[model samples]
Target: MSAVTAPQADRAAPARTASDDLDVVPLRHWGRWVAALLVGLVAASFLLSLARNPNLDWTTVGTYLTKDFVIRGVGITLLLTALAMVIGTVGGVLVAVMRLSANPVLSWSAWLFVWFFRGTPLLVQIIFWGFLAALYERIQIGVPFTGWHLVDLDTNAVVTPIVAAVLALGLNEMAYAAEIVRGGILSVEDGQDDAATALGLTRAQTMRTIVLPQAMRVIVPPMGNETITMLKSTALVSVIGGRDLLTAVQSVYAQNFKVIPLLVVAAMWYLALTSVLSLGQYFLERRFGRGRRGSAGPGVISRWFKVSAAEGVAR
Candidate 1:
């Protein structure tokens, strides 16, 4: 081997620096701690105020909290929520498919369905359905242009207030759900459809087995939120006396004049139900998010202090 050149030997070893040790001392997020402390103080104060407020009539809240009527109302509310979601999800899938169909007629019909239902307020729809007898005295199932009434039913008798409530909530949910489903489906790349076709899959089969399962990764989050929203929307059925939680509470408050307490009761139940749904959504997302980056992510404190890969790369 050749002897080291004098010029190379003259260059001193690179000077040591703090970074040379690779000791990455993390920064303390003092601002996050300060903000959290302030928020905690505010929340504590607000809760204290609520506890001290005598006008809330906590006695009434306790009295009717688990009353038979209230329990029945809770059952009815859950029923409405479940039924509406079932109708909405099934109808939504069909409507979404129609909206994406090649035929202009099918597409336009789906569009019109979404536009009309989503355009009108839920209250109007509920009231219209509740009072359908005013517009059409009877609901008749007969041959078109043949005047052969196979079945005839009184509108008032057939479409009860609860039925009207379900119809309104379900149809309205269908409109919004359709858009959510369509958006999720569209998030999938066109290549997916081509791949399915190349594999000899029918359109329906492709949608059911391939695109939809993949699309669920996108669909679940918003659909979860919509479900919670639908649960809350059941309160609107009170206007039509659908015997939901709010309607039952309203009846009690109407008699006792403990409006605030009754309202608090309803709010508590709604909160509890929504919290349960949120937990379900969280677990479902975790399931669908397998193998995705940041799916099961850092905690709030760590996330605040964390650095991005792109930032590290840039450095």
Candidate 2:
């Protein structure tokens, strides 16, 4: 057999065949498209109807949206959220640690705290704090069974509406946050603790430096959600006249008899605030999820949108 030279063989390469080319057709989910269209239409119709309804008093909504009372209420709401979240987060970590401690007393104490707070309704707790004076007219601090009262204060003066609101929200949130933190801590592998021990690190040092840092990947998403929930839950403070956003709106509507419009204003502000918090949460989740299993730089929503776009192009 005669040997073929490299260039001669290349010139004799196999011809392109029709079978090699594929005309792919992506499957269309018609039901999804129909459902999405129906939802969009209904939402648009509802919005337009609200816009055209004179009873809604969109003008009143615009009028009081940025009024001084409403603005102050917004500030108060933000303050309550920040303070409550701070208290909850700090107290949560402490409670979680206690719950995990070797001592049964510490663990039982933490459990009882979480159980009581979680078991009761948060609104009831707020009202309880608001009217704590009803339960105890005076708060005395001193040696028990001894007639020595170092500090004595009226309950009403000490636990004002704002104070009551903070106490209620923070303590309630601490219960839930305790569980979240405990779960996160537990998510860290036992081997990690073993490794830390082998490295001659104390338990506290191991947790503070190695374990907690790793557990943040599990902790941050739920904690962010809890923060948002705390923001919304501040509305309940209005019952005690804690001067939250809802309280300001209620005050105006009560005076002017424009309940719906004022409520619309409050709803708008709440939606806006929650949207901002959700955006921050998305970023935080993305940050913490880095290098973790099943974490691909982008988040679920972003990935979903990308996938939908690619599918659209394919179609």
Candidate 3:
């Protein structure tokens, strides 16, 4: 009887293990319900608002869409964005290099640049640049030791609205871009720089040929984000009569008295532009991310990211 019971107990041990594995604990996802309610409320409110406004005459919207003035506004917006990015990238690289330089002057200059630009309001800066031209009529650029006839800086001629926009946006953007670039540069492993130095490459050559290329792989996505942000930031240029999209919209509504509708039109265009930029960013990120294998494509990666983020909250 003891021998038979021992065998039965061994068999029962396996069954108990299986039972434990199969046990279903009650897991509560309380936040999921809360989130669902919030989402539903927001959706309902949007639908109800649109329904009440029923005046969204697509024909009027379509008619205003192709106007030459509006088209020009979009063009100016793109132009300002592009100009700011160019200036930002060049200036950012310089400041980043300066920050990383061995000389204290360069590093302090870079630090001050970032500190001041990042600290001040961009709108105030633009306005200041626009008005400050009155204080200085002309600037004289000359060699320190001898008059080598370097070009003069004509403040009166150069401080136009366009110049003001560029100066304001470009200077402001450089501060942020400098940090972005510096971070990306630092992200490169120390070994790479040491190897380049070992190979007898000058610091500049190593940076240009090796570090920048690799750093770009990290830099492009955030740079793309900055580009998109700069596009929206160009709207602030209108304060200085820069004539970008938002200003154009303001002018149209101010004159036409179709304030809400015209503003909505402006918003629609901004949304459309941002949507296009977002797609470009997605593709750019995908292009940069391609060497890593077994990774999902850009769109799916973004979707999964969003899903995982939501899951974190749900848990």
TM-score of model number 3: 0.78
Give every collision pair in model 2. none
Q: Candidate 1 has which clashing residue pairs, if any?
A: none
When 1 and 3 are scored with lDDT, the better candidate is 1
TM-score of predicted structure 1: 0.85
Candidate 3 segments exceeding 4 Å error: 1-38, 54-60, 139-156, 293-315
Residue 17 in model 3: shift from native, Å?
Answer: 14
| Angstrom error at residue 104, model 2 | 0.3
lDDT of 2 at 226: 96
The CA lDDT at 250 in model 2 is: 87
Instruction: Output the lDDT of residue 269, model 3.
Output: 84
TM-score of each: 0.85, 0.90, 0.78
lDDT of model 3, residue 188:
91
Quote model 2's TM-score: 0.90
Deviation (Å) of 260 in candidate 1: 0.5
